[model samples]
Target: MKNIPFISALFTPALIIIILSGCSRIYYAPTTQNVPLLTEQNELRIAAGISGGEEYEAVNIEVAYSPVKYVGIMLNSFHAAENSDSLFTNPVRYKGNLTEAGIGFYYPLATYYTAEVYAGYGKGTAQYPWSFDTIAPLKFDRFFVQFSAGMKRKYFEIALSDRFSYVHYTNIEEMYKIEAFSNYKYVPKNNQLYIFQEPALTMRAGLEAIKFQMQYQICIPFSGPTLGYSSYNFNLGIMLTPSVFFK
Candidate 1:
């Protein structure tokens, strides 16, 4: 929990504003990074979590399975939505979803340490309100490569992961008007590509079969001007390893 305070400080004010005032010009929202510290074959990990920050709140589902020796696969899905009904003055809403899958290699570094790398593709849509009645729907495709390493024990685990992504926005309709609501003046055009670097810290504690999990992640734009993207994300939930029960 050493990074919790620093992460909270980075986005607390902005989070408060988004929660209280609501936003109508958000461009990108981050999902939880899945880091399963698999140390052996035939291991299965499933996690369900809720993530919130910036302009959207999301539900994240992740599955990781090691079907063979030194090989693993992962699937992830996310759905996010938010509205401004509480504000009463600015009635806006945002919605988005994404799904991705990847296959990679994993290996044990020592008796208690493991590492993995994965590359995947995903697609989703984000709807941002331009006015009380007008909504702009944008679609995007994503390609990403991620690396993770961590230590695993019977009661607790900690991991660090970094994901590099290329996002291309498509089907942009009436996106230019976002400048009127948000700080940026330039809007992303159709098929415009943006690169991002996302780093996350993940922790799990409890029993070996099931554990409480929490993660904090930050997104950094690498190639494009800062559009209205969620700067950070926080997730909390539970993780299950059914194989532990069989053993």
Candidate 2:
């Protein structure tokens, strides 16, 4: 029987094919989960975390500010690299890097809920195992709407967020024309779009300004076809929400 590593590793080729094709935007889309809750004007919060999956490892960081009670702004970034240990074949090392940046708007929903909408763009590069040293580019844009409900207490807080994403790719044909991945199988059609929906639940426990956090995210299967992403992932990290100024 094949081990789980072999099964999971098989997807790499397909992912490599899709990434080089440039039609699917799934490869460069950020997989981080953001839950923003701003209760007062001039409040500032920063979060950082690392997440891992079968094929990739990612680092995420974000900063948010609530200038007024009813409005907030946030910026976030992500960087991911392929995991060489997950590869199935020897001497076939899959190498890739992806980076993303996003800006978002947040609105308070009642007393315990917050809603956010964000737009993001990213770029990626991959070197296929068969391609030796040549690298190919992948470019994409994305946007999402998210909602969160949480309870904030003196000692701890619990939050849950649902995020929906739409991803679009550009210059797919140009990527395929690159010399490195020119001979790969199942070449993809260019200029494609995809959608994804993810929901995450989080728990944070700590003092008034600093907290330890753990979160679980599931990529719902209904939105669109996912060629390069996993169905579920988890993140563990910390958040700092120190009050900046008095209103």
Q: Work out the TM-score per prediction.
A: 0.84, 0.71
Which model scores highest in lDDT? 1
Candidate 1 has what TM-score?
A: 0.84
- Measured by TM-score, the strongest candidate is 1
- What would the per-residue lDDT of candidate 2 be over residues 15-91, giving only the tens digit for each residue? 86665444212353236676756666687888888876655567777777776665666776666666544333224
lDDT for model 2: 0.62
lDDT of 1 at 52: 90
| Predicted candidate 1 versus true structure: per-residue lDDT over 34-147, tens digit per residue | 898887789999999999977578999999999898898999999988734555324666788999998899989998899999989998887777457877778888899999
| Angstrom error at residue 39, model 2 | 1.2
Count the clashes in each prediction.
0, 0
lDDT of the candidates, in the order given: 0.83, 0.62
Q: Where is model 2 more than 4 Å wrong at Cα?
A: 1-30, 86-132, 174-189, 221-226, 244-247
Indicate the TM-score of model 2: 0.71
List candidate 1 segments past 4 Å from native: 1-24, 83-91, 131-133, 177-186
